[model samples]
Every structure is written in structure tokens, then in C-alpha cells.
Target: MKQSTALTIATGVAAAAIGGLFFYARATRPPVINPDVPEPAKPVELARYLGKWFELARHENRFEKGLDGVTAEYALEDERIRITNSGCQSGPKGERSSASGRAIVVDEGTNAKLKVSFFGPFYVGDYWVLDHGDDYDWSIVGEPSGRYLWVLSREAKPAAAAVEALLQRVEALGYDRWALRITRQG
Candidate 1:
């Protein structure tokens, strides 16, 4: 009887220790810092913005790791935007993987901020258009949390000058330009 009681106490102590560690980790985790960066002055025209956009550069994330020839296609469906993202796993000619999601414009006036959901209505993520070209040839997508950033273009391969300029613009917005991984397109 005494041995069983001691075992029970040990188990309780172990559980409490684990609970304490989890609480400590949660409390000490760094929060996302969003700077006072300006959104696009003009609203995005859904019609002009539709179609395919090739990934030029992006802040490294696990979702698209080991991906190449990444492209995101947008299509208008009623009042929502359908998002189709595809990429090659190994290289430009590697195995292809795709994910589909839907986005709703958060503000009708600007059409710059959107809430996208891939897993039904429960899980949603932010999709903000920070900047874009007048002709919709290029765009910069980011979140208000400043955790993710992507540089996209209409062309599969954009010119060096254009990419340099885009990187400069991203840097000006207080993002870590060095964290951007130039996507491989073939």
C-alpha cells in the first residue's frame, strides 16, 4: 500500500512539472511585431489581379519548404477569391503538390486585406496586399503580424533589376530582406 501511494505521488509530481514547463514556454514565447507599414494606396481590382502569379521570393516557411517553381493562382467566385497554390517538391521538375483555399476581402474600399481559409471556416489566416504594380505585373503579399512575406510576379522569371527593386522595397518596409529565399523557377 505504501509503495502504491509513493508511485501515485511521483506521477502527480511529473504531471505538474510538465504543466509548469508548458505554462512557462507559453508565457515566454516572443510575440509577433507588426510595424507601422503602409498598405497599398489603391485598392486591388479583382478582375485585373486574377490569374497566375509566380513566386519570386518569400520568407522561409515550413509549408513551402523544398519547393520550387511555386505558383499561386487566383480566381474570382462570386464575392470570394479562390486561391490555388502549387509547387514542386524536389526541383522545378520534381513532384508537384497543391493546396486550395478561399479568401474574402476584409475591406471593400481597399480590397487590400483578406482572410483566407484552407481548412473550412475554423482556421483562417491573414492575406494583405502591401504593394503591387499598376499593371498587376508584380505584388508583395504579407500579414499584419509581419511573420510572412512573399514577392510574386506575373512572369515565371522576372528581370534582375525588378527583383532588386522589389527586395529594396521589402527592406524599406522593415522586413528582414535577408530572410527572403529567392524561389527557383524553371
Candidate 2:
């Protein structure tokens, strides 16, 4: 009811919001680019690329922190691609959480570079397909900043040899060996 009390409360809320933003920004893209991320893969068949993909490993981030059994599903929605990313929180048996977004090809020629927005027009994220299997069995994705990396496979539990090969390719691209956090598929 007092003016001074209201002022103090407002100030506290503002400070909390600012601090939250600071941490969120930090958890976002890496502060400095280390390994130079390459361009997107060419001749990506958008149609074939559609379907369910299990997340094998990734560069940990706040958004996906505490998540397990991660998976991304893609489907054609008119001219845009609908993306649904789902995972269990805390642990493999924990509650599930999902985020849906839409993606558009930034480079129509290659169909590898995509800008996806989960919060409508508020926020957008870039992801490029660095490489993939000939039959689209596995894929390596990253952004230009080299801060984020995602290794996905067509199967929930892919063969060890297949995953090792992909990991090798990822390391050859300059990504740090310890940066990847292998997901616990449920």
C-alpha cells in the first residue's frame, strides 16, 4: 500500500529480470567461436529429411538442460516445415516436455540452412545440416557460430559403429571432444 514499498518491489523485479536475461544470454551461443563451422550440406532432400529423429548427443544448453530421451519430429506444413522437439525432463523417466516450431530454408539452393522460430516471430534460431547419411540415417547439425551441435539418427538407438563414425566426422569438423553430452534415450 505504501509508495516506498511499491518502488522497492518494482526494483527487485527489474533486477531479477535483468539477471535472468544475463544468464540466458550466456547459455545461448558460445561467447567466442572456436572451431570454424562449415557451410550447410548440399542437395538435402527436404522430403526425405522429414520424419522422426532421435537426438544422440548435443552441446548442452539451458533450453535443453535436464532433458533426456530427446527427439525431433519434422513434417511438411504448407510452405513451412513444422518441427516438434520433445524430451523427458530431469531424467529418462521424468515428465515429458516439448516445443513446437516452424522452419524455413534460408538457402533454397542447398536446403540445408534453416531458421526456426518456436516463439512465433519473437525468437529465431539458425541450424545448418553439416552432413548426413546417404539414406538420411544420421545427421550432424550445427550453427554458424559453432556453439551448438546436434547429432541425430533415424533410429532411437542406432548402432554403435554408426554413431562412432558420425562422432569422428563431428570431431574432424573441429568440435571439441568433451563438449558433446550424449543423450539418454528412454
Candidate 3:
């Protein structure tokens, strides 16, 4: 009886240790932001190509520091999505940064999901459309797991009411309301 009790306790401890490790791995792993395939965002109904968009909010990351008023331009390059992001920093000289990347759609027609690669080797991340306005003035963008978020608008600054409506739609997608970082634009 003593030996059996000892063995059970040891097993329980081992299991607990394994569970802890698993949880830690999940919490510490770098964020992955891509769909399974290259899917194009739908509602091409919205004339996305050649539209100017301002980043209203985004998830915090190392790459963007003191960045604000960033604008992105999307265009088609031989059937692929080309992206150019530019923003300015606060300083005497007003420092600026720009990055260019390419994206591809995993789903065609109306699905509105994509995989974007910012690095030369093309590491990809999901670019899902959570919501879009009828006039295509604003949109809420997110990933499958809700880890990354972005709210974009055709104007440099979206209206307050529009932003609130967009947030409501984003909440329906299963993400914590507090997890979002609202971006400031000039």
C-alpha cells in the first residue's frame, strides 16, 4: 500500500510538471500570424487595390517603435499583393520608416483572408477581414486566433463612431477587448 501511494504521487507530480511545461511553451512561443494557405481577401467588392489606408490600431511589436500616422498602399503586381507601409516618428527631424512586403491570398472570392510576408524569405502571417463598410471606408483586420489586430480606414483618421462600430465587430470574433492597442495617427 505504501509503495502504491508513493507511485501515484510521483505520477501526479510528473503529470503536473509536463502540463506546466506545455503551458509555458504556448505562452512563450513567438506569435504566428498566417492562414494555412494563401487566401485572398474577398469583397473585392471593395476596390482594395490602389486604396490608401491608415493604421488605426495594431498589436505591439518590436519592429514598430514610436511609429504613428503610418499609411499603407496596396497594389497588384502580376496577380500578387504588393504592400508599402510608411510612418513617421516624433523627433526634431521627424524620423520616418518604411517597409515593403508582398502578400498572397489563400482563399479566392469573398473569403477575404490572406497571408503576408514582410521578410525576404517570405515568412507569412494571416490577414483576415473581420468587417468592412458598405462604402469600403473602414475595415477591421485580424488573424485566425485573434493574436494580431488592425483597424484600417481610407482616411488618415477614421471617425469615432466608425471606430466604435468596428471594435464591436472585432469583439464578436473572440478576442479580449483589452488586448488591443489603439494606435495614434497624425
- What lDDT tens digits, residue by residue, belong to model 2 across residues 53-138? 99999888778987899999999998999999999987778899899999999998889999999988978999799898899999
The predicted structure with the larger lDDT, 1 or 2, is 2
Model 2 clash pairs are: none
Using TM-score as the measure, the top candidate is: 2
lDDT of 3 by residue, 140-171 (tens): 77777645667788876667887877777656
Q: TM per model?
A: 0.81, 0.85, 0.70
lDDT, candidates in the order shown = 0.86, 0.87, 0.70
Off by over 4 Å in 1: 1-37
For candidate 1, lDDT tens digit of each residue in 1-186? 999999999999999999998898566533433355557556898889899999999876767877999999999997799999999988889989899999999988989889999889977988988888999999999887676789999999888999999899888777777878889998
| RMSD vs true structure, all candidates | 4.9, 3.5, 9.0
Which structure is stronger by lDDT: 2 or 3?
Answer: 2
How much does candidate 2 score in TM-score?
Answer: 0.85
Highest lDDT: give the candidate number. Answer: 2
